[model samples]
Target: MQQSADILKLFEESAIAAGRVILDIYRAGAAVRLKGDTSPVTEADEAAERLILAALARHMPDVPVVAEEEVAAGRIPDVSGGRFILVDPLDGTREFIGGHDDFTVNIALIEAGTPVLGVVHAPALHTLYLGGAGKAEKVKLDDKDAVIARMPIAARLKGASPSALVSRSHNCDATDAYIRKAAILERKTVGSSLKFCMVAEGVADLYPRFSPTMEWDTAAGDAVLRAAGGMVATEDGAPLTYGKRLPGLRAFENPPFLATGRPSERG
Candidate 1:
C-alpha cells in the first residue's frame, strides 16, 4: 500500500482502461468460451485483464495481481506475502453476453487478508465507485473527470426501500429465501460487481448472495462496501476476512456470503 491518493488514482486509471476494453468488445460482439468452472469467458475478459495487469505492473510493480483470466489460464500469481491486487476484468459475462450494460471492471488492493482499497467501474453506465483512505465516494467520469456524488460514509442518502440488490444472472435458491425473509422493499437486478457498488453508493440497502463465489469475485466490492460503512459477512454474521493461508493450499476461495449495507442492518 502506498499513499491512498496514488493507489486510488492508479486504481481509477486501470479500472477505466479495463472498462474501455469491456465496452469495445461488448459493442463489437466478441467470441465466448467457457472456463473449467463452467463460467462464461470472452476476449473482453482477456483484453481487460491485460490492460489492468499492465497498469498494475507499471504503477505498483511490487504488488502482485490475482486476476480472473490468468487464474483460469492456470497462471495464478503467488501472493504468499505482503500486499497484492485482485482484479476481475469482466465480472458479469452473462450480462455482457445478453447485451446488457450491467457488467463492470473490478480492482482491489488486499493487505494481510483485508482489502484496503477498491474501485468498480461500469463503463456502459459511466459510473465509478471508489473507496479507501477511511473514506468512500462515487464518481461519475466523462471526457473530463467530474465528481458527481462525493460524501463520507455517514453523509450518503438513504433509499426508500429495504433494498436488496442481487446478481442479475446468478441468483440461487438461497437468495430467494433471504429476500423473502428480509422483506425487501425494492429489488434491482444488475450484473457484475456493481451490485456491491449499489450498496456502497446508497442506491440500495443490502445484497445477499448465498451462492458459492471465488475471492476475486468479491474482493474489490468487499473493500468498497467495507470502506463505505458496509460489510460482507457470512451466515453467522462474521465480516469476510480474506487471504487465509493453509499448509498446502495454492490459493483460496470464498464461501457463500451475505453483503449488507450497514453493520446494524445485519439481522
Candidate 2:
C-alpha cells in the first residue's frame, strides 16, 4: 500500500513539473510543427516530455516509459512486462495552440493491461485531477505549485438526460452517431482528457470516441475515471488495454472506446 502511494506521489510531482514547463511555453506562444503522423506538436510538448521522462527515469529506472514525443521519434521502449508509464506531456495541442485552457499534461501507470493510476494536470486551468488506490481527487494549485485545496471525487450515477462530452478537436461521424444513438440530450464539446476528469468528478456522465487515438491520449484520464468508479471500454464492451502492437495495427493505437461516469452505461 505504501509503495502504491509513493508511485502516485511521483506521478503528481512529475505531472506538475511538466505542466510548469508547458505553461512557460504556453504563455509566450509556440512555434507549430507537424509530426510524421500529421499531428501538431510544439516546443512545450518536447520540453515537458524531456522533464517528465527524466523525472520518471530518476525515480523508476527499471520501469519503461512510453511517451508520445519519444514514440513519434521512433524511440519505443520495451513494455512487454505490462508495467509501464504513459505520458502525453501536452495533450490537446490544437486547443493549446488556439489559446484554450483545455490543454493538459497527462501521465498514467499501466499495469497488466489496466491503468491503475493517473494524473492529469491542466496548467492553464490551475486544476489537477488524479486517481489511484481506490480513490480520486481534484486539486487546486497555486502559481508556485503549492496545493491550495484538494477534495475527493467520484463518478455520478447515470440519470435521465445525462450529459455527454465530445472532443473539440477530434469529433467525427462515428461520434455523432454515438451521441444520437445514445439519446444524448445535453452535450458539451471540450478538448483533451478533461472530458474524462469531468466524468470522474460528476461534472459529466459520458464521453465516447470512435476516432483514432493513442494510448497516452486516454490512459491517464482512464485511470483517474476508473479510480473514481467510472469505466472505459472498447466497442465490444471490453476494458481498454495498453501496450498494444497488434498485427496490421500501428503500435499503441487505441480502439474506438467509450468512457462513462458509471459502469451501467457500458456500450
Candidate 3:
C-alpha cells in the first residue's frame, strides 16, 4: 500500500513539473513540427517529455518508461515485465498550438497491463486529476501550480438520459453514429484526456472513441476514471489493457474503447 502511495505521489509531482515546462513553452510561443504519422508536435511536447522522463528515472529508475515523443524517436524500451511508466508530455498538441486551454500532461504507471497510478494535469486550465492509493480526487491548482483545493470524485449513477463526450479533433461520423445509437441526452466535445477526466468527475457520463490512440494517450485518464468508480473498456466489454503492440508497430497502441462514468450504462 505504501509503495503504491509513493508511486502515485511521484506521478502527480512529475505531471505538475511537466505542466510547468509545457506552460512555459506555451507562453513563449512553441515551434511546431510534424511527425512521420502526420501528427503535430511542438517544443513544449519534447521539453516536457524530457523533464518528465528525467524525473521518473530519478525517482524510479528500475521501472521502464514508454513515452510518446521518445517512442516516436524510436526509443522503445523493454516493457515485458508488465510494469512501466507511460508519459504523454503534451496531449492535444493541436489545441495547444491553436491557443486552446484543453491540452494536458499525462503520466501513468501500468502494472500487470493495468494502470495503477495516474495523473492528468491541464496547465492552462489549472486543473489536475489524480488516482491511486485507493482513491481518486480532482484538484484545483493555482497559476503557480500549487494545489488550492481537492475533493474526492466519483462517477455519477446512470440517469434517464446520460451525457456523452467526444473528441474535439477526431469526431467522425462513426462516433456520431455511436452516440446517436446510445440516445445520449447531451453531447460535449473536448480535447485531450479531459474527456475521461470529465466522466471521472461526473461532469459527463460517457466517452466513446472510435479512432486510434496510443496507450500513453489514455492510460492516465483511464486510471483516474476507473478510480472514480468508472471504467474504460473495449467494444467487446473487456477492460482496456496497456503495453499493447500491433503487428507492424513498435510503439504501444490502443484499440477502440469506451469510457463511461456509469458502468451500468456501458452496454
Clash pairs detected, candidate 2:
none
Best by TM-score: 2
Each model's number of backbone clashes? 0, 0, 0
- 202-267 in candidate 2: lDDT tens per residue? 989999998889999999999999999999988888888999876766899998998998767653
Q: Which stretches of candidate 3 lie over 4 Å from their true place?
A: 246-250
TM-score for each candidate, following the candidate numbering: 0.90, 0.97, 0.96
**Candidate scoring better on TM-score of 1 and 3:** 3
Candidate 1 runs further than 4 Å off: 143-161, 245-251
Number of the predicted model whose lDDT against the real structure is largest:
2
lDDT of the structure predicted as candidate 1 = 0.80
Residue-level lDDT tens digits of model 1 in 1-267:
469879988898888877877787888898988789888899999989998898888888887888888888888677888587888888888988999888888898888888889988888888888888878878777644455665454313344557788787888888989888877768888788888877887778878887667777888888888888888887777777666543543466776677777666665
lDDT of each: 0.80, 0.92, 0.90
| Model 3 steric clash pairs | none
Give candidate 2's error at residue 28 in angstroms.
Answer: 0.7
Give the Å error, residue 50, model 3.
0.4
lDDT of 3 by residue, 1-267 (tens): 239888888888888888888888898999998999999999999999999999888889988999999989988899999988899999999999999999999999999989988999999999999987799999999888888999999999878878889988878888889888877769988999999999999988889998888999999999999999899998899999999876754457787889988657666
